[model samples]
Target chain A: MKGSGGARRAPRSTPRPRGRPPGRSSRDGVIAGRDALLAAAERAIARDGPRVTLDAIAAEAGVTKPILYRGVGDRDALVFALAERLTRRMTDQVAEQVARTEDPEDMLRRLVRGYLELAAAQRNLYLFVTAGGVGDKRLQQSLLLADGAAQQFVDGIAAFRSARGADPAVATVWSYGLVGSLHYVTLWWLREPSLELETVTEHITSLLWTGLRLEEPVD
Target chain B: MKGSGGARRAPRSTPRPRGRPPGRSSRDGVIAGRDALLAAAERAIARDGPRVTLDAIAAEAGVTKPILYRGVGDRDALVFALAERLTRRMTDQVAEQVARTEDPEDMLRRLVRGYLELAAAQRNLYLFVTAGGVGDKRLQQSLLLADGAAQQFVDGIAAFRSARGADPAVATVWSYGLVGSLHYVTLWWLREPSLELETVTEHITSLLWTGLRLEEPVD
Candidate 1:
């Protein structure tokens, strides 16, 4: 019972790998094996689209289905792991870009552009992780991604609001809302890629920068 | 095939009721039957929560599983129908409130309040329709809901932006983004029901009204 129920049953079908691959510590070998399987899964999904099956993924990795199960637990767990990987890459890219900019407006623009570009580059993987799955697992994956992004956002938003003498309490709500908006917008863009990246970025930036109203006081 | 593949397979197991129930036209009878079944579904879901099975719904409706299937097609179709029903109600409520308000700010506030209140009132049904389901079907349901709302919002948003000399071209993106933000915020509010309705409404209103920045001029 190394993992979930699916993984628990896997060992009976195929015994666990006996020893670490030459010269690596057992822990490092486990991490390396998992990484290799995930990369193979990514390749299968990228080639075959989101509906790529675990059997296909195992074949892509040159492993048996039971080995794939042992490596990733189940479809839901695999999706979760892939989602985490994608979001981490996107987050790191956005953070690196944000770090390079000091002006608030520039930082915002960089963040938006970074996120959209990364998602666009990894379109199939994005859809695979985010769009296709069972309901509860999909929702869990979404919440996991949003919560991680929101956690990164809340502190910065709170500090910024406080510096502006505004209520910082809205940070949690604002962060979640912002992430949700970005997520939906990205999906829309991916579906209708005819919209230029610059144009889409500009529209979102304008909306966030100026709000919905173009010319009315908020009285 | 009367509907999707699931519905197509349903007819053999439970031959659809052949005659109109007493005195009603065939079409009217079909409508009435569907309405009754849906109403029964609402009750079952309301009582048992979102994961209530088709068998349970059929029992609640005082019908056999086959009859339930014939009436509603399948789980996905039932979920789709329920989402349409809920969104229609919410839309009508919001539209009526918007019609009553001459002030733009007031209209926006009413729209937000109306959506949140209706969703909060129908919490169980809302979860059943939106939160629990298969992945592709769930995404389709969400897009169906969002597209309906976006269609309603786009014309109004375009008109308002045009009046203010803003780019009406951004209307489609803006409408979709707005709906997505409101939807995610509602889900967050529902899961953490401790937050006051008034507070949630206020925060969202401020975000849409003023955007993310508390202070600073766009370059």
Candidate 2:
């Protein structure tokens, strides 16, 4: 909610402009370089699961540890950046779908389905981001990323409800609750994808849909 | 579902039984000793959060690192044991409440209230157990604990719906989803605790109650 979620996304990895300063570290160059490194890191996570080390990430990027460090700071910083990137990508995908749909149930389906597909597609990376740990710093990082995603849902829900003259006062609580549900459900489902995607999505959609339409005051 | 969740509970830490042997380790002695160590570990977690060190745990138990190591295999093993203990305690609390309540809504309210209060009482300990980290091993431990809790809810839902003559086919999905919601909501609420307990519990109850009573099939 503090910053536009859209701004966090790096522009696509564009080719560096010709005649760039040979010995200068331009900001644009630095941003592009970091994006490329993150891309490499994503590939490594997809291949090696969440336990992929910084050394492996550097190797995957065809760079040394120092360069990797320079690109994304230390491991925690790298984790933060990766979390931001992934959350933003997910937000963008869901936003794109929301923009095209005015029906609340359809929007809910799109949001839930988008989340499931995104998590399933990046199973290892998602697991890497959410794997259990034991520390205050890790707790903060995990919450920070989750808050970002939840805020996006909050915004979407607010808009959805307001459009139909319904109070959106429960946006924050419901958004967090829904995100938590999606997260653990996706974690369980990824282990065994026996349940069809449509069925799971519909079940979730029905829950949220009915709950939202309740005549009882949410506030 | 595979095991009686009740069997997971270790008996109360009792004084060493009247000695049958003067110079050997007795099975009751071993059980009581480990339970004592686990109690000490719980105190440390309450005091120092999830990142409490083995040395600190050992000290809390009035023992040395080697003794702590001998009792619990390692840090991860200790974590696994603690998770089991906490999850089983939570399940028992909810199950007890469920047994007394004939009304499904009342049962759910009790379940949510019980979970929230228990989590609030062991704030640091709960956070320590749920903290995010690296490795598939950690993931497995976390999931194993969550699955246990989810299974308890599944059983509760199946019983509740069956008593009312409703098909309990969606109980598994609903159970996992509901557990995940409660887990994240509890995490968020513990940080703030601004909302009234009844309000939060009522909100969650309404969501689940309305959803579960849906006339449409989950499929």
Candidate 3:
């Protein structure tokens, strides 16, 4: 139902025609096969938590271990691939929501709220991906997401301060700082739902605004 | 040699005094014993990385599993205890440094630099404490640190903005935001140490200053 590609395909119970196979191209076959495996993996993860084994995942996908291995390199590789897909979806959503506001404050507020909402919507998936692992792939994926978000902010901040001749190089640092804050804040806020989302957003926006606004040096 | 309390004491080689041990209270004995055990655990963690086991820790501490268990609850408890100690040391140092600066901007800048310096000084220990674990104790320790840091910032910011009648309630959120940013920045900065510390500090401080200083409200 979540557009898991192959999950909605005709059930395995459908009998294959004798002698002649349907004209599903090899490329389409590979893509559908991978999608089906991923969908099965997702179900397995949801049912068995993030630590589910490859054997279980393969069984859920209605395939053998070899097929699962062929489709996705390995467990770590599959998790990393899923992370890419999830992070992309979350960032794309945040980007779209952030673009809705012209005012920088509103833009940041929306960004924060959008991020929180996404976390709430996909709390389990978030936990599965963020469940600390032995590999550095997760951190690498995280940094990739942070870097992408920071670049967007850098571009926006640089343009906003262009007339004042502000050194745009600082944007890289500031954007990282902002993304880092957002990342940890999301984790913290997710655990404490009693903390009002709007209030947190306002505070974050205020912090960003105060920091970004031009002012005399405070020595 | 590290101060590991009773663990560092002469190995049961000296003859016991005939009379009751002169003025060595039971409470003092317990305290010293714990310190010694903790010291041993620290050495083990330093040598074996964060994933070092309780058995290894006990061996390093010169005690058996029972003694280590009695001295520290378990592995998780031991880690939690160590986190408490480390977090306390780090925050106490930060507090002392922050107190030296009366200017708010200078105070915040000092706070940021102090935290990074602590991370750099004890990178291994930092990893030991922050090594991703199962239970939420790590998060709890993190929250404890953030709450402490936030309280300090809230008090300072409230006092600084008292004349402007700024609502101090927002300080809680701002403080957490600042702490989260610092936490993530430290992690990022650690991995990419090629970047100068002063530059990162300057960028972070600038962002904080721009956000904290009064300016026209963004509509």
lDDT, candidate 1, A127-146, per-residue tens: 77776554334445665556
Model 1 regions lying over 4 Å from their true place: A1-32, A64-66, A132-139, A164-168, A217-219, B1-32, B62-74, B132-139, B164-168, B217-219
Give the DockQ (2 decimals) of all models: 0.31, 0.23, 0.22
Best lDDT among the predictions, by candidate number = 1
Chain B alone: TM-score in each candidate?
0.79, 0.74, 0.75
Q: Lowest-lDDT window of 10 residues in candidate 2 chain A?
A: A210-219
Q: Kindly list the per-residue Cα lDDT of model 2 for residues B15-74, writing each as its tens digit.
A: 878534454455544533888998899999888776787899999998778678888867
**Considering every candidate listed, which one attains the maximal DockQ?**
1
After the best TM-score superposition of candidate 2, give how far the Cα of residue A69 lies from its true spot, in angstroms.
3.5
Candidate 3 segments whose C-alpha is farther than 4 A from its true place: A1-28, A31-79, A134-141, A163-169, A212-219, B1-32, B135-139, B163-169, B212-219
Residue B152, model 3: lDDT of 71
**Between the candidate structures 1 and 2, which one is better when assessed by DockQ?**
1
Give the distance in Å from residue A216's predicted Cα in candidate 2 to where it truly belongs: 18
Give me the displacement of residue B148 in model 1, in angstroms: 2.3
Candidate 3 chain B lowest-lDDT run of ten: B210-219
TM-score each candidate: 0.77, 0.75, 0.75
Best-to-worst ranking by lDDT = 1, 2, 3
Q: Against the unseen true structure, what C-alpha lDDT does each candidate score?
A: 0.73, 0.71, 0.68
